[model samples]
Target: MSYVKDSDGRWHTIFDQTKGSSCGPTCMRMVVKMMQNRDLGEEQARQLVERKNGVAVLSTLTSENGGVGQMGSHNWGNHGHHASGGGGVGVGAEPLAAALKGTGIKDAHVPQIYARQALLKTSLKNPGIAAVGWGGQWNGKRAQGAHWIVVAGQLSNGNILVFDPIYGIGEIDLSPAIPKYRPANHEATLYNKNVVLTAK
Candidate 1:
């Protein structure tokens, strides 16, 4: 469930599953389970899960189910058929949002796209605040879709706190690397380091 750097300079994590089930469902289940155990209210749970690492879990869930589907294909009945094509927000975001809402958080289902825009707009209203969306590219081509991230807060040391769903629980210095799915020519990638937030 966590990434570790091995002697081979590669990242690895221990994975567990029952009955060949995918980790996506299991991970979400764990999050929900943890929330219930703590008796966290909906909004509080939403904020907690919206932390840097929580978003990463959400992202993984979406990626595993195929990128979000396009338009009409997003309907549950049509998911499998159009999922392969990829365009709309995948099945993952809404459910996660809904779960957060169930905990009493309203509007938790903010789409990644909307989050990106809101981050930018909100930052513009505050000088010295900024936000950016950073992600690896397939070679020189932009990745098919946005991998949303938020950079917030300035520590006394001048370092920024990054909130990323794809990264883990803590603040990580950003870097770029090729994604697993791209063709070799597209191997050179930008890291998820773009500033999704900045001061106005």
Candidate 2:
């Protein structure tokens, strides 16, 4: 159910995320490959986060109560696909933009807010992939935190072809609402924050 067939009858590969906090790097890695025709491995993409953020890979967490927390820096929940967390940790809008720029994607940027669905479709048709900040769950649950996923392309039926690092590849119908961060009837949600790279 996660895979979809293309026009030429090829099924898209599902690049699932290995850690709860790795969605950012995972999506970025896919974007780089789609844009430049170069494959960046998981560790390499994590290192890219370190180089861009100017911080060592986050392997340990310091709690506010002066206690050392286990696993990654922040708690993004330990889901099935997300094993023990660490390495490259997490990324925000600004840090994600910086990381993309560091990868030679000079025009990479995170828009101030969500753009129109038409514009989003247009971006998907561009020369590269887009990283969407999602806040909903596959089960249609509303989440407080955001998740990163790649919008690979638009399906012929008007559904969005999404490469969710956490949930795998699937198509979803997005709402026409402006800030499409809220879930409607328990479906995939999207935040206003997005990291898009239209150029190599």
Candidate 3:
């Protein structure tokens, strides 16, 4: 069965929380819940994303940004619990790092590509949550584009458990192999990943 922090935790989903773009923030919400049992509301999560270097507003829009490329992350450092401004402009490493800096996990490491898979696996295997960047769905394939999601844990079967905000697949099996993006298939897959945040 798919797992989520709790029924209340699901409310942190992007659609439930932001009228704008927020895959990255929504994923962070899951990270906060996985790392800590806190049920960060969408409003609170959104506020954390907008903190510091977050792109509170985007100049352009993309499908991944949910047509609202004008907002930020959610969850940790969410003492403010602010709501998203409402646009789908997704964030990159810089914004994510900035958001981390504002919280107790300021030193969060975003690994370089060469070591990404290993670090992600190690963190999840160590029973830690990993906030990851990917393509939209990540259905055991390579990433075709950019999106954000959470790596909740590793299943006993050795498959990766992915928490896709849009698909809402709880702990779905993601093979160890990294799938590449195929224009024809459009299979949402994982590409690069990192231990977005963790316990100090």
Candidate 4:
């Protein structure tokens, strides 16, 4: 499978990855969609990642046992969310990579990308897709933590293109996405760290 674009050269429709805090899963969904050139809708994408990552069973059973909004004494609950409460918990690299491995997608690599240079060299250069972790200010505004977005491509002028599940499709105009983010293993506060999902 290869990345496909519309007649106008834009990526396909953007889909939300989760009803709750499932940024990793959502970004994985974005990677899958772009790599396979398919529009796997939001609900299905959310379910697939959860199913593969073992969150589905836990969420489903919890929902069944406690009607979705039932948050227990231990503060654990179902991913089948409601406006009230009781929603999903997010996963990190291990589970995200495991899910990708289970799919057996050729040329797919779920590796921890620690440096921004490497991310640009590998991911954006190929006009490829990457599930990137970024934080701090984005588009000159404050952003959230442990979040994920799919990098679609980059331009010669240093405009990094992406498809965000929450913010929709846009550009990551910032090189490294965060200049101050010192490269680290698990840090998501800066764009320096990412559990990148890359495919040809």
Candidate 5:
């Protein structure tokens, strides 16, 4: 699914990467849309980030029981077969921030927001799009690995307005979203740092 229509009948872009690993770029594209109101497709965002950041952002990443990394080409129990779970692959905070800056977004910064209070405070302070790293479960199913999404803003009740590449626009509570955060990993942490692009 490449898009989902919101209640207002506006079509929001959902970067479906079932065939490839490009969540980082997809989230960046969503940020561009939320911040600058410009639409950049998945491929375009991938190319732009890699080109601008001068680094390769695509790779086969795997996760097992909330763990992320390359552990051979095989899963734990089945050491003879290929890895059958987790497919999140994308850029880290530094590269993502660099890519945004390369696109002329001056307000991009990666902040360490590990708690809901921090996230709320940061979201309130910065009034633009945020590329948030999401893990844990979605739709009653645990995610294979880490994923990236766009945080448009915080609602009055303190829920975040999220624009997921796979789930589209919705609101999620900060409770479940925060604990799954593996702050030790750069790609899985919230915000990857903060990116609040000013209006153009």
Candidate 6:
């Protein structure tokens, strides 16, 4: 994905790649950078990054369930394949919330809270939080590595400074709806062609 500034002075990220291997780290780094600028302590910022990554959480979830799937299930449903897990919708939120519950920031409810906020058209007057999704194709078919992104920030101009795990830090307008699913490898190209966000 490449970050570009449009003529309207808004920064947009284009996902030109077929997979999101680099996307997660890019997004995480962007959020870290943003947090650093916000005066969050180094330990706190590192913890936030760890929660955003969700590797440990995913591992714990998998270990508890003897692997996460029903019978004959190749794909791990919403949790996604273990190798490509942690990038699914809302994956980052629960962990982050758990991490920052006692803190006074009140920003722990990032993933789910932001998702519902966007869906409900609520004002993000407090610390901004966002969730990301992979809405496009992967390898010319559906289910070709679909994923989600989580971003958080106060709104500046008409756009929100975002930390999209599927893309990266940038500004996205408030009119778009978050995607419900991400395509797996070999099934992404035709996964969500021409799908429009009618709400939120």
Q: Over all chains combined, what TM-score does candidate 6 have?
A: 0.40
- Would you estimate the TM-scores of all the predictions? 0.30, 0.64, 0.56, 0.57, 0.59, 0.40
Sort the candidates on lDDT, descending order.
2, 5, 4, 3, 6, 1
Candidate achieving higher TM-score, 4 or 5: 5
Give the per-residue lDDT of model 1 (tens digit) for 110-168: 43343333233322112111122223443454443323223333333333333222333
How many pairs of residues collide in each model?
26, 1, 20, 0, 5, 24
RMSD of 3: 8.6
Q: After superposition on all CA atoms, how large is the RMSD of candidate 6?
A: 9.8
Best candidate, lDDT:
2
TM-score of 2: 0.64
Evaluated against the true structure, the overall lDDT of model 2 is 0.50
Off by over 4 Å in 6: 1-28, 38-90, 98-106, 111-129, 135-137, 144-200
lDDT of 2 by residue, 49-116 (tens): 64654443332221111211263333323322212212222555456567767877787765554544
Q: Model 2: residues >4 Å from true position, as ranges?
A: 1-10, 54-89, 117-143, 175-186
> Candidate 4 clashing pairs?
none
lDDT over C-alpha atoms for residue 127 of model 5:
32
lDDT of candidate 4 over 115-150, digit per residue (tens): 455346544323333333333444454433334556
Q: Candidate 6, after superposition: displacement of residue 59 in Å?
A: 9.1
After superposition on all C-alphas, the RMSD of every candidate to the true structure, in Å, is: 11.6, 6.3, 8.6, 8.4, 8.1, 9.8
Off by over 4 Å in 1: 1-96, 106-136, 139-142, 148-154, 157-160, 163-165, 169-200
